[model samples]
Target: MEERQKIKVGISIGDLNGIGCEVVLKTFEDSRMLDFCTPIIFASNKTISYQKSELGLEINYNGIQEASKALEGKINVVNVWREIPAINFGEATKEGGDYAIKSLKAAVTALKNGEVDVLVTAPINKNNIQAEDFKFPGHTDYLAQELEGESLMFMVTDELKVGLLTDHIAVKDVAQAITPELIKSKVATIEKSLKIDFGISKPKIALLGINPHSGDNGIIGQEDDAILKPVIKEISESGTLVYGPYSADSFFGSDGFKKFDAILAAYHDQGLIPFKTLSFGKGVNYTAGLNKVRTSPDHGTAYEIAGKGKADHSSFKEAVFTAIEIFRNREEFTELTANPLKKSRLKREFR
Candidate 1:
């Protein structure tokens, strides 16, 4: 097999009070990981050393002033802060939130400047990571502002791919939020992502209904029949193959989810609940439709296990690998698109 050029992966240290640093350190502990990509951690070396001392983890890394200084075959730490802040495990402190933003902004700037090829962020406390400069719900919204294209939260694994029609919104507001324009935009973004990012030439997407039993043909509620059905019909007729407004209740349980390339859920919990259940805590939260690649673990900061050294790094590892893979896929897609005749066999599905 030919050795591919190592991708420069920018890492953000999320919620210092939580297990963000723990999982990140653990993921890169094995030196063999360097064979795939050069990692530039966007946090002070002091911060990482503190976490390592508490957790008893060790890994050799290079400390650099910027992402451009990162070297292949070594882990690089880009000092985003000068002072070593307090480390209060299992607590959400104001310092934690502020530092998380600092790391994030630095990494994003690196991405924008093309110093880093892709990004894999650790978990951040949504409630605490809110302030004047960063008032968005989570990473997706923040990245949408910093990067190009409409951001869609796509939780994915090998077998199942789930996306949200509405993420990080209240259930009460969901009904009003699910408009025809919104559905078309989200679907179009997801479809484009499927083809370019996942390398699926002809993608088929499934849409889960909003109400119970998909409104039971308007017997329960009219949102599914009145809003979702008409929009789906119009989109399908316009040429992108689509299915559903399928009853959300039986879609995953009946194995109906596996039949399509992707599943679009009506809201946050509607999509994520089933996705987490099916993925078994190994899913990667990919920010689709962005010009630059960014992904993170589906699970948030595990505060309870923050300093216990028991935080499972599987999801975090997958996040890193997924971002790297998507970067390669986009390159392949571009190459294939340039050669129109060879586009027929572009690449395999995300699964």
Candidate 2:
């Protein structure tokens, strides 16, 4: 049997007042998590302890000064903040927001330095964290700025994968944001990521329309025909298999989504509504086209369900597994990239 190469996964504790701690503790409690990677959580020791006690969870955490000393088969923790006041389960406080941001920064730093192979983030409250220092709408935007890449927010399940062209923007502003350049860049990013991160050589992608019934051939609206059509044509001509500007209403029911590897929705609600309905508790949010691979559970911080021991850990577990798979694939791809013979052979085969 081949030895399993252990991936070092860095976890950011999201809003401490939410179910982030509960899910993290629950996910790591399983011994199977140790099989693929060593988990390192960026959070305060006290906060973790409080959550474990509150939830009656029996997971052991090993505190480490640095990521380098993380031990195999143990949940290594890098403490960030301490002495936070006890949190009300459903309430968002300024302190909780600050702490969550601190943890996220620490994890990002570790990833930038190559201390971790992949990053699995817990949920954070966007409203609470939207202060002067934290101006980004959500993780996707912040990560895009920090990593300096064309990032797309993609939600993935076993059956469906949805990518967003514009996220966390007003419905009124969505149309103006959908430019040809933005659409082309997002489609290209999704194409490259599907090949590198998801290990698909030729990925088929579907683009959803911005208007009803795909704008009824320009009677309802013309953005789909004007902006999206040209971008789709350009990408298709370049040898990438992309389809659509399909009507958002009928796209999911026609089994239209099943034919493609991923769907590119024009805006947030267009993509997320169907995805969340189909994959409520099972989907993983992956930020594609970053220098480092990052994934988070699809759902946000469920403050109402925090510390009740009612939070589901399935998504978090899936996130860990997804990160491990991506890390392995990336390592293999990197090796192939470094070998000229393998690279040439691959290029010849594709050609």
Question: How do all models score by TM-score?
Answer: 0.96, 0.94
Clashing pairs in 2: none
In model 2, which regions exceed 4 Å deviation?
Answer: 1-4, 338-351
Candidate 1 local lDDT, 64-177, one digit each (tens): 888899989998999888898999999999989999999999999999999999989999999988999889999999999999999999999878899999999999999899
For model 2, what is the alpha-carbon lDDT of residue 119? 94
Q: Which stretches of candidate 1 lie over 4 Å from their true place?
A: 1-4, 340-351
RMSD of each: 2.4, 4.4
- Candidate 2 residue-wise lDDT, 128-147, digit = tens: 88778789888889999889
| lDDT score of residue 96 within candidate 2 | 84
Error of 1 at 338 (Å): 1.6
- Alpha carbon deviation, residue 105, candidate 1 (Å): 0.5
The lDDT of model 2 is 0.86
Please state the error at residue 51 of candidate 2 in Å: 0.7
Candidate 1 worst ten-residue window by lDDT: 342-351
